[model samples]
Target: MKLEQVSETTWAIVDASTYGNVGCIKLPKSVIVIDTGMTPPLAKKFRKLIHKEVGEPITDVILTHYHSDHVFGTQVFQDCTLIASSAMAAIYPELLNNRWSPEGIQELKEYYVQNDPAFAEQLKDLRIITPTQTFEDSMTLGKENEVHIQHTGGHTAGHSTVYLNTERVLFAGDLVFCQQYPYAGDQTNNPLEWMRAFEEILKMPVEIIVPGHGPLCGKEEIQIQLAYFKKLETWIKAQLSEEISLEKVLQTVDSSPTPPYDLKADPRLKFSIERWYTFYSQDEG
Candidate 1:
């Protein structure tokens, strides 16, 4: 876990030891945290770090999406005003009653216990904290409204990006994966919306970008992701025209594209391909 001062007013945990990056925007009297870490303990430690480093009381926490990696640690900010997109907030009830329920959490812990015992330990006393405030499309925070958060569904239906108008920094939460293959297997992931989100980010005068994961970057990275997704869309459509079985299509396009990205061994590669294949298949049907 490394904390980097992205700008005069913004700081980010770019190299998360667990998963998902976290960021905060320091205001005159308060600080607004962008997504907590992957677990309760991690977020608790991060909250303490923010208070010590930023020297301001945390007033609000903005959730970029509903993924466990980005949201499960929200319990640390229960005292603050937790905010999320309306689409994201709506899913919390179902997630709480189902995937985040005690039984569901135990099942998750059991799975992790086999794979990552340390992480499973972190989930021991985990608690689910839902957003207290919701936004429709876009909203602004800060005394001068310098913080702009907009819902740009792509990676997930409720995914959003936070931009600092004055600092020229963009906190691209999972919308931009710096160097690795993104997890596009989410049920709500949409290639088209993802591309549009990239386009929207390009339009901003962003000097720095704090991606949801990986090192800090700029618009160049966004362009690369956009181009990659466009190529993926084209390839998927071409494959569909052949009317071949989905299995055959997957087998034929097993190799990852190179010029832009070479994430052939990335675990999410095949999963993303399959999800995109299913999405296009259903659309064409």
Candidate 2:
């Protein structure tokens, strides 16, 4: 497994193409894993990587959400408690059973075959897990070191973030994507509600952020993302007040408020824009 040392205590084994991002957080009581990459087979290999890095077994596996990429690989650890948000555990089975998402998934499968054929073979029969223990708000793991996992679902209904209080590192799941546009195509996506969720994340006192898809970033990057979301909300509110048609909003708004939003250049932007118009207007009415 290719590992990137994101911070002092956090390491990311990222899926370069698509469908993977597994992080390991070393806490005082024990090492707590953030996400479980692709499948049970990959999870076994991930164990070796973790043992090599921390020289200890993963005491806990905390899944940030129920998306296929993040939660499929939970069988590697021998003696660890698997965790998922209460909301995630509730709806996880449905997402796993329906395997029609070839677009995002193909990216990872193609890459894994070339880089790690053994792992690709292992991901063949996937195992989806329900949280052994569930929490409504925030939860902590490895109390000696203090890893505070904050639960704020958006992007997916049970998405979560993990924080190391001493290290001040946050493992932000699908709540924020790095270079590409976020997928808000699910039935659970609520654009305006997601906007409110972003507000809560901005209030976190964090120094370093390990996003679900990209490299670790600073608090300033978080501010920029928050600002982008704030602009989106304001723009939507203005359109509603002006009594403008949803079509106009869809045309005017691009990927984001900034110049590079380039709705025409990226196909994914259409879905995001449509989601915004449909969701917010319904809320307004």
Candidate 3:
């Protein structure tokens, strides 16, 4: 795990060179970790890295969403209060334990371990972790220090983020990703709603933003991400008017908007485009 200084109290643990979303952050009064890495070994390595850097254990662990990649790491920080959106907190157990899950990520359920040798043995033997506390829309933290935790759901039903009022940093979770187009596969992903949340983020006087996956970013990146959502709106509108196919839409999209990365191989693009189309088409219907 590599750490980056976003601000005075804000630090990010970058997991790998590629798909570096497996990271966390430390605040002044309490430390808030973003998504846990995809498995136990990665999570353990992450904890060691954090302890080495902060010189103290994690006081709080926030799982942005219930994806196996994110939640499997929660077990590593049992000493801290496991936090997540009420919706996310509720959905994790069945999703983790049951052979069948709604998201249908059987490959991640079955073969992610194979892909990452670290996950090979650890994940198979882990126990279920249901969050002790839950919140509906928004929550606060560091009351003595006036820190805030905001829930801006869109990517998933229970997707949430942390906003540290002190450092003016926002942990965007999966609602906003860096560089690549977003993954909107869940039933709760409303492009319109997601776009609004993106817009709302602009209202905060945040200096830095930490994403669930990828690098820690600044204001310009936030605008770029918001623009991506807005572009989806425009593209989806074009599709509805012209009755274009998904492939045609892809072809029409030049420059890709997802810069510094080739999103063609990423499966998230297909689902993201589909969700974007639905948001626009629903209005016509």
lDDT of each: 0.86, 0.69, 0.67
Quote model 2's TM-score. Answer: 0.79
lDDT string for model 1 (1-285, tens) is 666788998999988653899999999998999999899999988887887888678999999999898988998889999989999898888888999888999999999999999889999888888899999999999888999999998898889999999989999999988887777988878888888888877887999999998899989998988888887888877777878777886676654364246776676777787888888988832
Model 2: per-residue Cα lDDT at residue 201 = 60
The per-residue C-alpha lDDT of model 1 at residue 95 equals 85
**Model 3: how far is 46 from its true place, Å?**
1.4
Error of 2 at 18 (Å): 7.1
Query: Number of the top candidate by TM-score?
Result: 1
What TM-score, over all chains together, does every model reach?
0.96, 0.79, 0.80
Error of 1 at 130 (Å): 1.0
Compose the digit string of candidate 3's lDDT tens values, residues 1-285: 576666666666544521335445554555666667666667777777777776564677777777665676667777788777788777766665564343444544467566875655666655456676787887776646445666666787787777777768787877766766567766557666666777788877877777766667776776776676676567578677988876777665553445234565676776667666665667832
Off by over 4 Å in 2: 15-18, 96-122, 236-256, 259-264
Q: After superposition, how far is residue 11 of candidate 2 from its true place, in Å?
A: 1.9
Worst-scoring 10-residue span by lDDT in model 1: 252-261
